[model samples]
Target: MSLHSLDVRQTALTLLRSGVRNAEVARKLNVPAGTIGYWKHMDRAKRGECPGRGSHDCPRCDGVPLDHAAYAYLLGLYLGDGHISHYSGHRTLTLMITLDDHWPGIQDEAEAALRSVFPTRGTCRVRVKGAHNIKVYSKHLPCLFPQHGPGRKHERLIALAPWQQEIVDEHPWSFVRGLIHSDGCRITNWTVRKGKRYEYPRYWFTNVSDDIRALFTDTLDRLGVAWTNCTRYGKPYNVSIARKESVALMDAHVGPKY
Candidate 1:
């Protein structure tokens, strides 16, 4: 429940709709600027209006120069564990990436990528059980992430746009890093032979989407990283990079999530 009166909140919304900045509205209403920003975000969400709709900052719409490396990494993250959803009437969209709490460092990197790609938009973190949902609202999320559509990503075809492919081509390691951070991991296995123990480090990428797995392997092939399909629990959904050379490459590039 809101502590502020309905009328006061409405006045703030009205002022906001009429071009008053969030800080000015906060001053006029004696509300905290952060509260005002929240109100504005919710109000815009309710009305199905993007907070910065029609602004000339969208990379696709405004021809803004995109940070290709950041975007490529983010794209991999999105493909691995990201989601985009529409609110109200589809005018506003929210992009969310659910990350495990065990890896706060990965969370920081994901947030940095989001900010680097969409520098002007605000990003927030919502805490859920055992994880965090890093969220950003925008009207142009679809433009940036065309893979967003109705139904589960694995249920639908996931293909990259030509430009996105170009970016991934230019920054394949970054893309692999994002994917690894999101839905993949590096693990060490030890074995004993002749009273000696040896440890083998390998990379595993697991995704239900065939296309996504293919994309990961394709990029690995381009990078000269050998990979193989591994079946676990009766499902062939894991891509394993256990070859010494490939593991070395992965260690040099993606490494284990800190």
Candidate 2:
């Protein structure tokens, strides 16, 4: 006979399905960790689902339809400020995107995009040192983000697959918005010309990776947005969009991060 009630078991299963760690669920429900583990094992057996392997509805692996716009945005965010790490002793991989805590809207958008990309999976937000990390776990993240490889992104060459290229081509604005949200920003610059003050808004994308900068500029070219390379402290480390028409287009689509 099971020591725990059916209600308790069901609650435990629900939390487990949402990717909550066993220890967390146990603490929340006031149950023993070993007991929770055993319950999870038995529940998987009952449902004929493989443990550790979990359930995957990956668009790449399972042949399901993908939200291309959401994915394009997520790809930008990933390329800008996201990373994937493998869970030790498990087949699961966790994807985390860090955003400034002050921009709650951007954080929310990031979370929504991640959920849209992985509707069947669960997501969590954690705060660390003035930033919020939106994280999700899946076994097939590698299948989706083939760009994931060893070493810092700036240290390696990054290229897009054919299918990813198609998505970015279709949803360039979303991609730009994601990149801007991650590593780019808009600011107003002022100057005095003929004793008259003039102010203009400009977009700046700074990344150490030449490949990533190329990707951003290439997308801008496709969108008819003009950009220039800017030097900071004697280093060419920024892409500046200051053309009036280009800034207008960016304002129409991306605007200032909020």
Candidate 3:
């Protein structure tokens, strides 16, 4: 066909679908640069009109990451407290387990286990339709809920940085206590009576860290810090940053020397 007889829209669609540059199309067609985009976008919305898989709209939303609002919204929907939509692509309500990820690739198992553990009334099925690799938060999810399938031989502690190791070795309780918030919720938070003892962050009553034996020596020995022990020289039942008025309490206390 003669160049004058060519359909720009048809030509644009063909080129755009192949991931060709619009400028190249414009240079060939001798038309405005944005005309290809305008035609392609308009064509995509009409059913059966899109050029091909790589066309302007065919995988348009594919591989685009979800934003925080969408993520949080999906989470809320799982607990039955937010909007649920059949047409919406995000359907599963997933909470991660707290262990480091070495689990076999059985997201389906985890999804099925979630449905079994926490039943829902929705018609849509819970499924591992996707795999999300978040940097930190999601890494520990499977650890807290180990029933995704079968757990392995043991749970390994994460290797700490040098400073963290010093803290871990010396004030192990403090190290463990500090991790509750960063990791998932702790077991003590789930206990009934023990959970009610504190009034601040509910997490204060929950998580437990790996206990290091050096905590009694390094933590209590620090001058100007006051901690209480229920039994003399035993691990503390209650420990705190000493109040200014209570600084005097440390004077008479004998720390676990050596």
Candidate 4:
């Protein structure tokens, strides 16, 4: 086949495997619609795997190399409230993080974290459903989010892989930021004593998983951020950083959500 024909076939197959319709792929590539359909038919006859869909096959779809800060942040989001999934019959992977609709700058931050990891592929899309949610699509999500498996994260043994542990060791603060921003919050507290009122800022992270909570506390310890842990009656475990110095450290590193 001529180089031009080869390029067209490759592009056509990529678009098709991504679940794009033949007519749309034809329009995007300026090829005849029938040409795309024909190519897809031929490829199916050969029973070849889609370029980026199979396990550990395509280097391009193998998750991006772990960037210490970026991966650490992404890992936190995953452990906290994020979800990763591959819908039945779909070749694309979806990574979603839901945030409070009222939280300012959160969408921007989530998008930024995604872009940092994805860089090129997978456009991050935001939708509001009672809360602002960010979703990014990519075929490499399995590689990036290997922690995804059967059952809830709390029900599963959610331990970091060697690579993830290395990143967290180097950039614990970013990991903490992502975890806190998702499952934790920073707020001001008010108290009264002897006819006077005082206000203080505190940071707290709550989660049901013991392992995840341990990871959060360990990261805090590594950074020398003072924190206290407790379990509320019939509630998830809570970790609070209320000391002024520790809060200041967190503010310098993680800051408020957004």
Residue 141 lDDT, candidate 4, scale 0-100 = 60
- Model 4 / residue 198 / CA error / Å: 1.6
**What does the lDDT come to for candidate 4?**
0.76
Runs of candidate 1 exceeding 4 Å displacement: 1-53, 88-91, 194-196
Q: Would you list the C-alpha lDDT of every candidate in the order shown?
A: 0.88, 0.88, 0.33, 0.76
Query: How many steric overlaps are in each model, in order?
Result: 0, 0, 12, 0
**What does candidate 4's lDDT look like per residue over 1-258, in tens digits?**
223478778978988878998899989988877567657754642342233434443333554354568778878987897887656555456788887877658667777888777776555557677676678776556556667666788898778767678789998988998999889999999999998999999998999999999999988888999999766896768999999999999999888875
Pairwise lDDT winner, candidates 1 and 4: 1
Clashing pairs in 1: none
Give the distance in Å from residue 142's predicted Cα in candidate 3 to where it truly belongs: 32
lDDT of candidate 1 over 151-212, digit per residue (tens):
89899889998988999999999999999999999999789999999999989999999999
All candidates in order of lDDT, best leading: 1, 2, 4, 3
Please state the error at residue 75 of candidate 3 in Å.
Answer: 13
The worst-scoring run of ten residues by lDDT in candidate 2 lies at 45-54
Model 3: per-residue lDDT, tens digit, 142-213?
A: 222222222121132323235333433544333332222122121222234655653221211111212221
Q: Estimate each model's TM-score.
A: 0.78, 0.78, 0.20, 0.73
Task: Kindly report which residue stretches of model 4 are placed more than 4 angstroms away from their true locations once superposed.
Answer: 1-65
